[model samples]
Target: MATIGIVDTTFARFDMGSVALDEINKNASARTVRITVPGIKDLPVASKKLLEEQGCDIVIALGMPGSAEKDKMCANQASQGLIQAQLMTNKHIIEVFVHEDEAANEKELAQLMENRAREHAVNVVKLLYKPKKLIKEAGTGQRQGFEDVGPLGM
Candidate 1:
């Protein structure tokens, strides 16, 4: 069985992580290990490192950065660290992030985060157990973004 890791932060909505776990379990028979940190500042080195050291194959990292510039800086730093961790471990570290101000309202932001988490959870299962599904879904709106612009035109 494949072992998946979840590295999350308290700054994000807890339900988002819970939903991700449910999605993962519903899709595939796998073991999931979760590590929750105080905030995104600790997600990269602390939680992810611990999970990787404990033998998780791929890690799904979730964090919610604030709209402020400083928060974005910190998020970027953590992301860079995660990149290094991925290189060192030779495992995929899926980054799932939602900013507070991305949506006009709180409810919309929550929904967006939940949607992103669940979608990524499915992706985790597909990547680990059934890559063909992932291939079929590719270029088919699996990304967690505002909208699909399709191909650019002159």
Candidate 2:
């Protein structure tokens, strides 16, 4: 069976990793390895370890960037690190980042976190077993936390 790695941040207001795990369990028969770090900046190293040491085939790096400018800058730096890790490991690290400002209220924020995580979990299943499913979705504007914008008129 495939092993899926999940790296989440404690700084997040919601436990999106659990939501992803549930969705992954429902969609595929795979073993999941999860690690909880302190903040978004910690995600890259934790995720790299999951792939390099824990032998995960794919990893989901989940983080919630706060609504401050510094937080956004930190998120960008963390994202660069994640990309570097992926290149060094030659493995897929699916990024699932939700900005806290994306939602208007706490309730909406929680919902976005759950929705995004669950959607990306399904993507993981596809990447592992049915990659062509994603090919069919290309350019469809498939948003995770909210309604898809759909394809624009060409």
Number of the top-ranking candidate, with TM-score as the measure: 2
Give a tens-digit lDDT track for model 2, residues 5-119: 9999999999988999999999999999999999999999999999999999999999999999999999999999999999999999999999999999999999999999999
Residue 91 in candidate 1 has what lDDT? 79
Estimate, for each residue in 1-154, the C-alpha lDDT of model 1 and write its tens digit.
7788888888885467787888898998988888888888787776457555777888888999999999999889988988888887777888888888788988888888888898888887878888898777666654564554454354
Model 1 bad stretches (over 4 Å): 145-154
lDDT against the true structure, each candidate: 0.80, 0.95
What's model 1's TM-score? 0.88
User: Which run of 10 residues does model 1 get worst, by summed lDDT?
Assistant: 145-154
State every prediction's TM-score relative to the real structure.
Answer: 0.88, 0.98
Clashing pairs in 1: none
RMSD of each: 2.2, 0.7
Q: Judge candidate 2 at residue 67 and give its lDDT.
A: 96
